[model samples]
Target: MSNPPELPEFPSPFNFINNVPITLVELRMRNFSGQIREKPRWWEKVHDADIVAKWRSEIIEQDEKVVEQFWGGEKRFDDGNGEKKWPREKITGAQLDYIFDELKDLAQAIDHETGIQRTAIDKVYQSKTLIPADLKTVFLSGVSILESVPPEEQDWHPGANDQVLDLVHPSLHCFRIGRSPVLIPERTSGCPDPLFVLTEEQYLEMREDAEGAIVSQFISTNYQWLPTDFEVSQPGRRLYSNITSILQRFLPLFERVLSDSSDPPPPLAVAANPGGWYEDEESESDLSDDEMDARWRKFHWPVIHDPAPFSPPTQEGRTPLSLNGRKLQVIIKLANIVLTPERPKYPGGSWHVEGMVNEEIVATGIYYYASDNISESKLAFRAAVGDGTDEAGVSWNYEQSDDRGWTVAFGLRQWRSMNQELGSIMATEDKSSLGRGRYSAFSLSTRRGPSSRRATFPAATIVVPRRAGKVPALRALPQEIWDMIMQYALAGTVSLEEAKQDRLALMEERSHFVIEHNREIFEVEFNMCEH
Candidate 1:
């Protein structure tokens, strides 16, 4: 074979990856001058001093029998000094409130003979928007699509080393444009519109007809007519409907994130000379080298201030995200991790985003529908930050030489890649049972935004296949001729086996691209002296 064509280079570092142009926002570095938005700690929300004081006063005013009845019993404790203390003084405000809330909820559930709400359980750890108990049945039905496939037919996640089984992964058989071997186009010109999205009913019907097949006949045969006359399969019909229901529940949360990300909080005003410990030049001149160094370190390395409280605008205040009448391109994935006596623990997953640039996924929603006998797992998130060299609109009025102080104020470290830890979400498990598994479903939504260079589909008429007996013209054709016609019709598309290999290759290429890109953006050291 002759030498392969050389890959063209682009001006930007994050231009083309795996032959697809990356979105600018995909790896966009954030400035560090703004107030960090973080979820409040459990204590902060529930343990307000004023609220606690009012609760204590109320409890003290009540009679002993009334207090006992309200609290389910006499909640008294002996202090170290041997003084008897009621729960008002002994228990924290948060603890007392949580107890009362739980008692009230339990009483209501018992009276109505209904199951306790998942929100009550989640409140113990202050987790919000969890998959409620009632909705979990629908989510679990979507997860049950995995059972239809045989053990041998199941496809394990490519980079996960057989640890993760992809029951309905979009990466396996994603919609493709252009020719074989290179499904993704190099440029957006002449590419089909990537905006056509499947309706919930259409998506479900397609999956239902596929019968657990990885490749859909409708899409393969009508590759040129995708997003119009094509069908894609994943998780069966029931699973698709259930996933739609589950996604509806998470729409508000997704909308909130989208809203917040688009319009971030403003930065807090930095004081001219914060901490008030910097010495004048005359005082510094009098100090010895060791004393000066100590002073610099103290001024530079005072404890990094806590992030500001995250309080986004309420739904009524903000403009509503209208998704009605709009078709959505959704990628569904159901995953389960089983733990037995032999394998008691799971090591968790590597740091990675949802999809490659080709997928153009904007928002990802994960629902932990089932977790039994598993340890408390959490999904941590981090983002790339700017190197602070060219932070516009920020001017530190402190001493010019205090480079370290600026780094500390920005919550960044010198001589390190600027990657900020953006907290994690708890995927709490039930430790009541043993040797069970955890099941979760992921729904990733992709849209064709202005910045997106993803490919779309061309409008075309669908050629519906008819039964052999129903089509007299087809029935009259010889077996060999009919086979030739079928082959010619599918000549534009690759086989299921070829598609699987291509998916693996694409995943591997994307993985390497992400690793190298992350290294370039986040692993390089920052030197203050050079600046």
Candidate 2:
């Protein structure tokens, strides 16, 4: 008897196999590879002579106004004489040309289709006037929820050193899928299907009921109330309808980013050179250190050369990118930073993503609704491209001598983890000036799956710790005795030992779940050669 020969595996373009879906991380990687050599949509527009000329003319025409608007007033230049004059009145022709050139470059970098500002492609979107003017009153009314909380009862974000106030944070009471017991009965074969969730009418009705319950509690507690208390006259609903309305307004922008990430277009066969890079060494001898360093960036910057057209694999029954009939889990977060003479500067935030692997968060939208007397802040973005292992045989086949050419063309460094640096969005007073307090709303969109269920927190379980104070009795006890006392205090039950054991088991289960989920999505090796 002869054994059958092993068949060679063929690569499939589809994002699924046997009805099972691929991870979002893998899809992002695929999209990245697919567009490796493709030029950005703005490449041609930025290079067109007529377009560049038009942009230059426009900048020159609006130079004075632009200067005033940016500088927050007319900026006067100090001439050698005693007189201080406007920049246009005192500056040379070269200074004006330089300003115009910079503005032109900025205008060229923006892409209308993606609504992406600067040179970061389609990753970030910003709008100054997305929320309607009428919604301002409603938003302020919702903000009263935070203002109502007493200073002593305010919930500062964990580990934020009393700087960040969390009015409504999902991390405190989030929907825990699969861990909690299911309340809703499972659908049977003959049972009618449930109506769609998050519809405008249904949402408003739910909000009204929830708001009433919350306001009822506030009134019962005699909290500092305001005329805007009517806005949040419900329980369960943390944010008023104002937040919902704002999210609805930005839905289009969210959709655009999601579409680009999930189902990107095939790469186009076009060559785009951004220019201004020193391509030859002839001019290097006369250049200064800064000039040389600037020119050398072309070698280090990532760019794809001679990109060929790409045709993605076809999936027979693939669903198009849309939110029309899908179920979405939205986690809302509202927080504000208070800066005074004592604490004038916010040192900025660290680099991190939105949620844990188990959360299945696909997209995040942040709205800086208000700020005052603060310096400029920016929200930058970066992505984990790869661990450099994938590029060794495929994209890194150049010698040291060819480093300049390779880097200039490919825009990647060899033998290193690829952390693609995306540009930033500036958050300033002029950009987001709705109220006196510096408030921000964060909405994280997580895709709901069939096996997932929302978990609710019991009001009794939530314990807000008192302000810093020493417990003299506990401080005198040994470490082991102190730990046991804390465990008993936390359990508050006769079966304290059993509860402790159960807690350990639950912790292990959650840890395993998170690790497994992340491994499935992010731990695999991405094949860059596929594209």
Best by lDDT: 2
TM-score of 2: 0.46
TM-score of every model versus the real structure: 0.52, 0.46
10-44 per-residue lDDT for model 1 (tens digits): 11222211111111111111111000111222223
In the range 66-118, model 2's lDDT, one tens digit per residue, is 33543233222111121111222222244334333433454554445434342
Clashes of 1: 2
Clashing pairs for predicted structure model 1, backbone only: 193-456, 194-456
Off by over 4 Å in 1: 1-135, 180-235, 269-287, 290-318, 387-403, 429-489, 529-531
Q: What is candidate 1's TM-score against the reference? A: 0.52
Q: Rate the local accuracy (lDDT) of all candidates.
A: 0.37, 0.37
The 10 consecutive residues of candidate 1 with the worst lDDT sum are 453-462
